[model samples]
Target: MEKADPVLERLEGQIAWYDRRSQYSQRWFKWLKGAVLVAAAAIPFLAGIEAPRLLIGGLGALIVVLEGLQQLNQYQHNWITYRSTCEALKHEKYLYLANAGPYASAQDPRALLAERVESLVSQEHARWVSAREEAKKTLEKLGP
Candidate 1:
């Protein structure tokens, strides 16, 4: 059996972390989309007024459509990223497990593996935090 390359193993770990993160991000997008749809549906009733009522309703509807489209685009992008990452990780994991029989266990190797995993986890956390911040900024741009 072929031995797993450490470089490939590390890449796989990173990819796996990203795939999970993408799944979570997609869920958030879905929720946002739903809220947009509900707001869009209520625009007419919510805008009940004589002056600028129709204008307000139209603007609300427009905003909802735009937000929904943006969320959908983000969702699609995340899915594509997630799929590619998952495939890479699976390939790397397969190779790593297959090659484990040959390599003699060493303290240094174990430490390296632990560090790699930790780094991947940290990177994923940072990505999620960045995403949240972006979402907050977007919301702020939309309004108070």
Candidate 2:
């Protein structure tokens, strides 16, 4: 496939980076919560007392709070990605319309416009695929 336009490539890179970072943060939080829960559950066995119950309860509460915060952060990140993607698409459409005649054929204006629109649509689709692949890789790196 042809290389993506530089501007689009940069935007995609930024979005991918942000997504990877968010996923990493989420994974870390999950691991931390799991570790805490495991430790809490083991406390009574290790201490030979009823401390496990208290520890587990406390850790559960902490996990709840952490989950809430993580959810909020994910929400905010999603908003940012949504806005950025929309803005980028809008700009692509505008550029397509502006250069329609030049990029394709001026002899048949409607045909040229259609061709430009198709090209932009294809580019957008490819970008989406690339972004998704990047996200999948990042998620994989974070573990299952």
lDDT: worst 10-residue window of model 1: 101-110
Residue 31, candidate 2: alpha-carbon lDDT: 68
Q: Look at candidate 2 and tell me the lDDT of residue 16.
A: 61
Worst 10 residues of 2 by lDDT: 70-79
- Model 2 residue 82 lDDT score: 45
On a 0 to 100 scale, what is the lDDT of residue 15 in model 1?
Answer: 71
TM-score of each: 0.44, 0.36
| lDDT string, candidate 1, 1-47, tens digits | 99987665666667766778678767867776677777666666566
Q: Can you give the lDDT of residue 76 in candidate 1?
A: 49
Residue pairs clashing, model 1: none
Residue-level lDDT of model 2, residues 30-135, one tens digit each, is 6655765775566556467645666656666776665555443443344444445445545544654576425444675445445544454466556656666766
The parts of candidate 1 lying over 4 Å away from their true place are 1-5, 44-73, 99-144
